[model samples]
Target: MKFFTAVAFLTASVSAFTTMTPNKVASSNAMAFSQFSQQSALMAAKQVPHGGVLVNQMTDDKDAAIAKATVEIQASERQLCDVELIMNGGFSPLTGFMDEAAYNSVVENMALEDGTIFGLPVVYDTDDESLQPGTTILLKQGDLPIATVELTDKYVPNKVLECKQCYGTSELEHPGTLMVATERGKYYMGGKVTGLNTPVRDFPCKTPAEVREELPDDKDVVAFQCRNPVHRAHYELFTRALDDPLIGEGGIVLVHPTCGPTQADDIPGTTRYKTYEVLKEETANPRVVWEYLPYSMHMAGPREAIQHMIIRKNFGCTHFIIGRDMAGSKSSITGEDYYGAYDAQDIAKANAEKLGVTPVPSLNLVFTEEEGYTTADEAKEKGLSIQKLSGTKFRKMLRGGEDIPEWFAFKSVVKVLRENI
Candidate 1:
């Protein structure tokens, strides 16, 4: 019987992923999801099943999630402990994995990063800022665990793909494609209207409970929500915010990158994730906190800037970094008319209670050989002429494969854009 069963299993190309067919093999041993994000998977699995065949990417009955990836261990930390091989899909710990001898063989043969053992569930979406949801991490000799992969759809019993993405605002047509979302996101308003609606998250999606517990017992937590990567301009804004008396308490700077959609020619998500990873790995600021914000981008430009401020406020961000053209867009005609270039300041000033936070607005900055984060005043005083690059110019330079000097961007960040963008 055992031989016959083995033969059947080998002959049949049983999918290692989802069970889409009507083959009912009642096996009691099913892989489990983490306690934190398990219920969401269960609910989604009911609709799509594991490794279920994708009939169509457009309307497939699958759990649609936005994900981000960040290498957690410190780079300088002890020559790295035994690294785990992560699998893609869920955060399951792979147990009884190959022996150390076998592991050494694999490591010796391939680059440590290119190791073939997929102990974690990883998806390569360069679009995710800080490795938000929709990814799974695995531990060697344990079950593979999918991280906080969030859903952009509403999950109804039986039909997971039955939901609508939020239209940025009324009077604006909704450009939605049908989708099934997971935890760490919302379908409607993308948490803009409801304010990071708790219902949007599939798991607890809290601050890792332990992180919250381990947080310094400060009298106040002044969080800085970053929708973009850590650019020099961003650093300057953060420094300014950190220096502010109203927001200087505990001097907490939380870098929360958007976990959803961004415009074309924008820095890919993985690069953003790597940017934060390096920052966390290298920055001298112990007060900086990093969290993944799972809100999708609308590319609505000025309205997006306002929305960012409001949403950050909802997420307990005491203040937000409102950079020039927070989410700028170009008008259809003459390539003119940017959306809400001043929308950040205007919204925060006029609708503080409605938005629920303070907006630290900063103008577009250019690096000067002399002055670091200079404005028109500093430019004149320091005798440093500021040569700012427009979004169009930057994109063109990238496409033309031109080198971005330190005067324009950090070499490391520029390398990320050149490769990922």
Candidate 2:
């Protein structure tokens, strides 16, 4: 019922784009490309998926899988998200949950047992000591069976070490560290998964193969990752990235947003999905492709950035937009930043060549009353009047129903948020 409800809303919202005249659409496209004369001449070939293969564990025989399961375990929200990704090849090279060996290797080194680069370990955790090896367990979301894992190994993981190595902190103030410390179970289980069905979500995530089919084969696909709604500056950042020299000519930008569990205080995925759906219809840009990713945020800063690049690469992306302090978090108690502003960009740049995915550093663009959006450096040089809006102020305005500046946020996105929130 929720799926159908969202479909109806999307249908009505999409009519907004149809209302725009042909001339307006042409003008919009022309304005977006005014500064990129050389973009038409650049060409970037698509990169191969990580591990030279995309893993799909979905089984054709659902009844057989149900019969194979000896026990049923309800999956948590995070586990459900992970199952969707692993089943869809979004987490390729991972046929199932990581075994003890793979988990230890990933924790000690940001690589699998074969030394393949991996951002973080993916394992199924449980507190049940009664579960034994070789047991086939059915993973379910509520009453719906989604996947089954043939248990091969189980071991207690070192949570403190995982927090220190993966997130660079053992402090509970950090959301990631807190999740590992308190939310995750005591034991980690690894086994190959056979997916039976995909979860029903507000946003339908496309499979890697499905996305690749729609991508242009000869042109580069620049992936933009975000965990929040796309505001005006965010829109400008990704659209303008197509003109970056590192991106191949005639590249299309993939506005891929993670629509899964994020920080406890962040906006809900269903709400964020509505904002993106409306924005996509309103923009109607052919050069931009919109897709939702079912990835739970780790907020692991540099390591998370690498993880994003590898995942995007599996989606046939040839370049990724690495912005300032990507996936960075702060200490709740001290309000101290965990990673440097350029830490993600630096690490992404360093590993770009090896990953076969080029990293495009996001421009530090600021809003100016005189010339619209421009680099912060250029705005300073020209002495332009910069417009400022803090997150706290924006939330207050939204709650009060005050008019948000069109220059700071898209009117359509704001309307969706207001109605939903």
Candidate 3:
């Protein structure tokens, strides 16, 4: 019986597999897939964006496990059908089928039957999503993503969803327009904008404008802007927003987390999304909607903070949950680094009218022992169980394999992170 296994193997190799001279082309010039996988791994590492040339150059023989297997060439959509392909030559028990260094390098250029996408062998500066015919066009420049699309853009600038209940002129909000350090010619909103969410089962999925239009219109929606991993504070903020006495209704809370290539220690997009899924399932938060943000991190905490707010508006959200250092929380505040903890809220507080969505500043929430966001700040100070959690700090814990406190993070969110960390 013939079986089909779609392992990430190489298509060809250079001059190392053949007993015949390096340049000599013999009858069995091609070796087995295993041979190519092992040898090709070596050649792949030397080059920056590993490619087939490194594999083919391994030896004169082509020895993939299966000969003439179907392969999807990286960068371009040159698909080969019915050919044997070799796996990455190296493997490890701890990791799995391939060497982390070589496997990672090669996978970026190759995709298996599964939908795992990797970066390409381009020069460092030219790195981007694997460009293919069906690739999602989430980004066109530096770091902006399609997730910035507005839930309500008709009245705001370039917004797709109009505020049906908005009291003032239904303003069209700008889609994905964040005021990042503007020094005149350095950068400016080109009037072009993109959204941050789309339907997909995996990371790096392509954004379809047609598919986006198909999202069921939510007369009532709750937008969740996730720049960092999900923590107790995030939960506290959103639950409060959804349960707002004035704003609470039948709104759907969108589980929108940015999925673009974020820094290490920061939760991987897939892990974060899965955590959100578990949270969604555990809670009967009927109004919650879930989708990964397709944009990459700019590390511009404050400015990107405003951008997140504006994007939520395009998504048809009437309110957004703002976290500390929303955009640039990686570095320190005074060292020309992370956005100030309150910058995101500050920006939102100043621009709610100009941008249009109701921003939830952390200050408004009065954390208490009994309830998370209580309006008790006016009466008396209360001790909160949940210690303020930080994404940067969370990542350190993730990398360290330390347990995140249930108080800082929901018990469920912590469980998911522990498994994936």
- Tell me each candidate's TM-score: 0.48, 0.89, 0.46
Please report how far candidate 3 places residue 160 from its true position, in Å. Answer: 33
**Candidate 3 ranges with C-alpha deviation above 4 Å:** 1-220, 245-248, 330-337, 363-405
Residue 92 displacement in candidate 2 (angstroms): 1.3
Instruction: Decide which is better by lDDT, 1 or 2.
Output: 2
Per residue, candidate 2 scores C-alpha lDDT tens digits across 309-355 of 98999888999999999999989999899999999999888888767
lDDT of 1 by residue, 1-421 (tens): 2343223322332121211221111111132122123332222211221222111111121123112222321211000111111111111221112222222222233111223222111111111233322223211112222222121111111111111112222221222111111211221100000001121222123322222333443433444555456766666666666766666565576666764445444565556766666666655677777766544555544444554553333233556666665555443335553444676467556655444456666544556767566666677777896767766787788789887655555566666667776
What 10-residue stretch in candidate 1 is worst by lDDT?
187-196
TM-score of 1: 0.48
**Candidate 2 regions off by >4 Å?**
1-45
- Candidate 1 residue 129 Cα shift, in angstroms, is 35
| Root-mean-square deviation per candidate | 18.5, 14.3, 20.9
TM-score of 3: 0.46
* Candidate 1 off by > 4 Å: 1-228, 301-306, 381-383, 391-402
lDDT of 2 at 168: 92
